[model samples]
Target: MTRRQAITATATLGLALLLLAMGAAARPLLVDEHPLSRPVLNPTEIGFAQDMLAHHSQALIMTARLDQTADPTVVALADRIEATQREEIGELKGWLRMAGASTVNNAPMQWMHPNNSVTDHHHHAATPSETADGGPAMPGMATQTELDALSAARGTDAARSFLHMMTRHHYGGIQMAQAANNLLTDGIVKQTARDMMTNQTQEAALMEIMLNSLTTAR
Candidate 1:
C-alpha cells in the first residue's frame, strides 16, 4: 500500500478508538440517570434487616425488665442475650444505612410471606394492649402483658418468667433468621442470619432444660 494510504488508515483507526473511549467514559453517567439503577440491597434483605433490628430491640427491652434478684444463671443468660443482640442491632442498622433504607419496617414480616399481602398498617412498635389482645406482629414475640408479668415477678418466679418468655422470643427470632438464611443467596446478612439461627437454637434448648429444672424444683 502507498505511505499516504497507510497513514490515512492509521489516523482513521485512532479516531475510532478515541470515540470508543469517550463513549465508555460517558456510559456510566448515563446509567446513573436511569430510573432502573441497581439497588445496593434487594427488598428481602432490607426487610429482613429492618424486622430483625426491631426484634432485637424487643429482646433488649425484655432483658432490661428482668428482675435483678433472679437466679445467677438466668441473669447471666439475660446479660449474654443483651450484649449479643445489641451488637447485631448495630450491624443491621449499618446495613440499612448503607442501603439508604429507613431503620423501621412499616410492614413487618412481609419478607417471610411475600404473597400474603401484608400491609404497612402493622407497626414495629405495636402497643402493649395490641400485643396482649393476641396481635403480635411477628411470630414468637411476647405480649405486653407477659412482659409486665415478668417485670413484676421476683426470685424463682422471675427466673421462671424470663426463661419462658425469652425461650419463646428466641424461637420466633430463629424462625425469622432461618427464613432470611434460606431466602438470601449469599452476603453478610445471610451469614449473620445463619449465625443467629445457630446461636438462638442452642439458647432455646438451654432454656428448656432450665425451665424443666425449675418446674421439677417447684
Candidate 2:
C-alpha cells in the first residue's frame, strides 16, 4: 500500500477506537447499585419483620419474670430464650431500617394478610382474636390476664405458668417465622426465620415436657 493510504488507515482506526472508548465511558451505571437498590421489599418481608419484633418483645417480657420462679431448669430455659430473642430483635430491626421501613408500625399483622380498610389505631372487620389496641392476636400469645397470672404466681406455680406461656409463644413465633421463610427470598431474612422455627420448635417441646412434669407433681 502507499504511504498516504497507510497513514489514512491508521488515523481512521484510531478515531474509531476513541469513539468506542467514549461510548463505553458515557454509558449509564446500573441503578440497582445505588445505596437504596431495588427490587423493593414486598409486604410480607416488611410485615414479618414488624410482627416478629413485637412477638420477640413479648417473649422477652415473659422471660423477665422467670427470675421469680423456683425451678432452676425453668430459669435456665428462660434465660436462653431471652438472650437468643434479644439478639434476633436487633437483627430484625436492623433489616427493617436498612430497607427504609419504620419499626413502629400500627397495623402489625396486616402485612401477613392484607386488607385495605385496616389503618392505624383501627381495624374494621378485624379477626375475632385481634384487639383494637394491639392489632391481630398471633397464635399462642398470652392475654394480659394470663401475663398477670404468670406474674402473680410464685415458686412452682410461676414455673408452670412460665412453661405454659412460653410453649404457646414459641409455637406462635414458629408459625410466623415459617410464613416469613415461605414468603421471603432475602438470604439473611429467610435464614433467620428458619432458625427461629427450628430453635423455637425445640424449645416448645422442652417447655411441654417441663409443664408435664409440673402437672404430674401437682
Candidate 3:
C-alpha cells in the first residue's frame, strides 16, 4: 500500500519475468537450438524412433477400426490410445528430422538386438511380399493379413479379436519404449521415453479392461 512497498513489488515482478524468459531460452530445441542434452540413441535410437512410429500408426489404425465398428469399450480405449501415440509420433518425427535422416536405416528386427544375432519371433508380421526386396521391415508395422482379419470380424467376434491383437500390439509398444528408457543415455529423451513407457504400460491395462467388458457382454 505504501509507495516504497509498491516499488519493491514491481521490481520483484519484473525480475521474475526476466528470469522466466532466460530460462525458456536456455531450453534445448530439436533443431537450431543446441540440444538440451546430447543424444544417447546411437543405432538403437533409429530403431526406436522408426519402429515406434510404425507401432503408433498401427495403434491409430486399430483404434480407428474400433471407432468405426462401434464398440463402446473399444472406442473409449482407442481414444485414449490414439491421443498418446499421436503426440509421440510428433516427437519421433522431430528426432528423425533433427538427425537429418529420411528413414531409419536398420531393419525393424535389429531393434531387438543390435550387437547379437538374436532370432526374431516377431518376424512374421513383415513378409517379403510386404517389403521392398529384403529390406529391414518398416518400423512397427503390422502385416496386411492381420489387417484383413481385423477388418473382417463383426460384433463380439470383432471385439474379441481386437482385444487379442491390441494386447499383442501393446506388448510391442512397451518393448520399444522400455528399450529406449533402459538403453538411451540422453537425459531428456530418455526421460521422455521413460514417461512414455510409464503411460503405455498403464494404457496396456485398458486392453484388459476391454477384455473383461467383452466377456461380460457375451
The digit string of per-residue lDDT tens for model 1 on 44-91 reads 999999999988888998999999988899999999999999999999
Positional deviation of residue 128's Cα in model 3 after best superposition, in angstroms: 14
Error of 2 at 166 (Å): 1.1
Worst 10 residues of 3 by lDDT: 127-136
**CA error at residue 16 for candidate 2, angstroms:** 6.2
Clashing pairs in 2: none
In order, what lDDT does every prediction score?
Answer: 0.87, 0.78, 0.68
Top TM-score prediction, candidate number: 1
Tell me the tens digit of each residue's lDDT in model 3 across 1-218.
Answer: 99999999999999999998887877654245653674534566766777777777777887666535657667667677788788988888888787765554445647556664544535444432245333235333455666667788776777777777777677666766777877876765677778877786776687788788888878
Number of clashes recorded per candidate? 0, 0, 0
Which ranges in model 2 have alpha carbons more than 4 Å from their true place?
A: 1-25, 29-36, 39-41, 114-136
lDDT for 54 in candidate 1 is: 87
RMSD of each: 4.6, 4.2, 13.4
Candidate 2 matches the true fold with a TM-score of: 0.77
